[model samples]
Target: MSDSMVPRKPPSKGFAKKKKNIILLSMLAPGAIWLILLRYLPMFGIVIAFQKFTIYTKNPTLLNNIIHSDWVGFKNFGFLFTTSDSWKMIRNTVGYNALWIVLGTVIAVSFAIMLSLLTKKFVAKAYQTLMFFPYFLSWVVASYFLMAFLDPTYGLINHLQKQWGIEATQWYFVSKPWPILLTVAYLWKNIGYSTVLYLAAITGIDTSQYEAASIDGANKKQQIRYITIPHLKTMIIILFIMSVGRIVNSDFGLFYQVPQNNGPLFPATQVLDTYVYRAFMATNNPGMSTAASLLQNVVGFFCVITANSIVRRIDEESSLF
Candidate 1:
């Protein structure tokens, strides 16, 4: 029997599947490497949260500085609670987050529904583009734009006030309106993103359900109540849980840059992130900043777990495990 007379066996399905899986894994390699390096590897430095974390020229290396730092137990954590501004910052952070969660969900869902109802596709796209542009603008740039509008002497707002026979108010110097301003700013920049999410979910729904409802004499509101809301209930719960997890993590740029770090606005605008930044800047302490960040993430993690557990109890299919 010559070799040429032997028949070649076909590749097995398991082998083909393994090859396909290898290709898919190869495609994911870059992102996996990036995640490991930038995210998980940094977890090793978390010990800095409990140390004095001093730097020196003896070794002049990151690992050396971390290894040489002295442990101070819970001293760094005390900085968050012992200050006079602690209560205020915590209150502002939680209050703004809670309010934004409510407003963001309501406004985003409403806007998404309205956009979905638009008969014209281009008009809906135009509106989405207009709303989404603000989300991309950095807080630094946003602050400059805000300054242009709120500057007492030359701002467009003051200019309009003069035209309307009203007193030109110095906006940054005032604290009373800051909570409202910050809320509006957050929604203006963020609502579009959430709206798009909900809109995508809405588009995935079967048009026949709506059509059937319409034929059954159900009105637009009734259809939304019966079909749409029930379909979106999962997404709403997921987003709500995610938002709750981030309740302790304030946006540093929004609190710090947007208000130009004004002194008077601290009463209304100060948050844990801004407080950590100020403390680190004043004391040049890495431990305090690291501790605060660690605390925020720990709290956020627990919040996510607790929310997911509650959801699992109510609806296992919709729960985010």
Candidate 2:
């Protein structure tokens, strides 16, 4: 065929564009559907917070119940705040979470920095694997493991006490030691995950900074303080801001199961989550539970906003938003 008369292939711009769009949509489909179903869809149920919800009615469908239920403005919330245990629940919840956020950050960051500085890769990986083992453990399993140490008659603690000629203590019945115990448990379960995060951040740091610091005669401590810590500050602040959002929400299993639901330890252990669970189980009033949940969400939302605002003011780069 003559050179000018040869057939040329059609352009593929449109087909390529369409194929790219399809691939993007396919990749996003699962996550988009998940968010719609699990996150956005449940937001509609927040209306039930204001309604006195009943599970069994002549018409038991969700829409029917929502429409038929009586609206009680803020009364459900008032119920949560009016009881004598209200202050106790708030105190325990906020107190324990505040402690966890602070201690968890410090311990996790310290561990990550130390681990990253390890001379041997195999030793560091082994230690990391051992530490991370607890993060996968269910809180129920962790509670039983804790019981093995705190069990009144035959626990390791009591066994040691007996060996030392000290009287065996009823650990579950006592509230004094629980704050420490719960903090320990929280650290043990969570430190591994947080360490992994911080360690990942640490690994991303530019090694040139350390090399320059070394050239400047900065010691390990000096280099860490000036370089490594500054590099991690952003991640630390971001995580702290997120943690603040959950300040009102207690770990239900940690507060409920860890103490074995001992009534005597309620003063130390009962937080907003456990309180709401107990109240719902006792009264079957979804309204009150929903109100509590709604309040927590609202508070958490504001907390994130406030934390981000504060971070923005101090260090704009570190703000979550």
Candidate 3:
């Protein structure tokens, strides 16, 4: 046999590397397009916030010629902050979001922990499906459902009160009960996703660790406290850190639509998102909405930075960075 006739490996065909590149590019293309169209492209509109936008103006440049449309740097932001509604919106946003984070984490973690303990796969799957169903519903749909139960006249709550010989209550227009209602609605709608996330994290834990804990005569609660929670610490910290970013942004539909936009509920229901919507409605200023959104992003960025720093200080492993 001639040495020249011997077969060689043919340089791996470089298929693996080429395939990886193709896969990465494919994955990135959709997201890149989405960000450009929906997220990044709209950033050009930020200039509107600086300009005195008017409907009569065909374009900002043309309006600048007819009117003294000069840059009012920080003036809109100043108006936002100086208004009486500013403090109220900020307070409502922070309060509701804080409550949501704490309660949501607790309920989701507890549900996930309980689910992990269930031996029956079918039962667990059924529970998960039922929980997830609500998450799929749009806020508009959920608002209608909420109103059916809470409406002042024909609502179930009012009907029940009447049946019990009590005066039927007007709840939709009231500010007092909204904090609790909003929190409950948020939990009901959001718990499924968080539960699924925590469950996935739990499943990733090594079974050998649990067996060893069992051998050590650890009770279920002890196993959970020592093993499960410690394993989840990093995920918990990461999710909480993410939640901090949205502390200023409320669930707009929940605050706006659920209360049916009745003015009486403004004190309790108004948050930065809803307040911005109302402002935009009155003045037809997209700039104010943009400004509000930009402010939210700025605050969220600082909050995330601060939160991650604190997390890193306490536990470097748990820090998102």
TM-score of each candidate structure, all chains considered together: 0.96, 0.95, 0.90
Residue-level lDDT of model 3, residues 101-184, one tens digit each, is 999999999999999999999999999999888999888999989878987787899989999999877896668988888888
lDDT of 2 by residue, 9-38 (tens): 986999989999999999999999999999
Question: What are the C-alpha RMSDs, in order, of all predicted structures?
Answer: 1.4, 2.0, 3.2
Best by lDDT: 1
Evaluate residue 293 in candidate 3 and report its C-alpha lDDT on the 0 to 100 scale.
87
Error of 1 at 292 (Å): 0.3
- What residue runs in model 1 are displaced by over 4 Å at the alpha carbon? 1-6
RMSD of candidate 2 to the truth, in angstroms, is: 2.0
lDDT of 1: 0.93
Off by over 4 Å in 2: 1-18
Better of 2 and 3 by lDDT: 2
Predicted structure 3, TM vs. truth: 0.90
* Sort order, TM-score high to low: 1, 2, 3
Which lDDT values do the candidates have, in the order given?
0.93, 0.93, 0.87
Evaluate residue 47 in candidate 3 and report its C-alpha lDDT on the 0 to 100 scale: 73
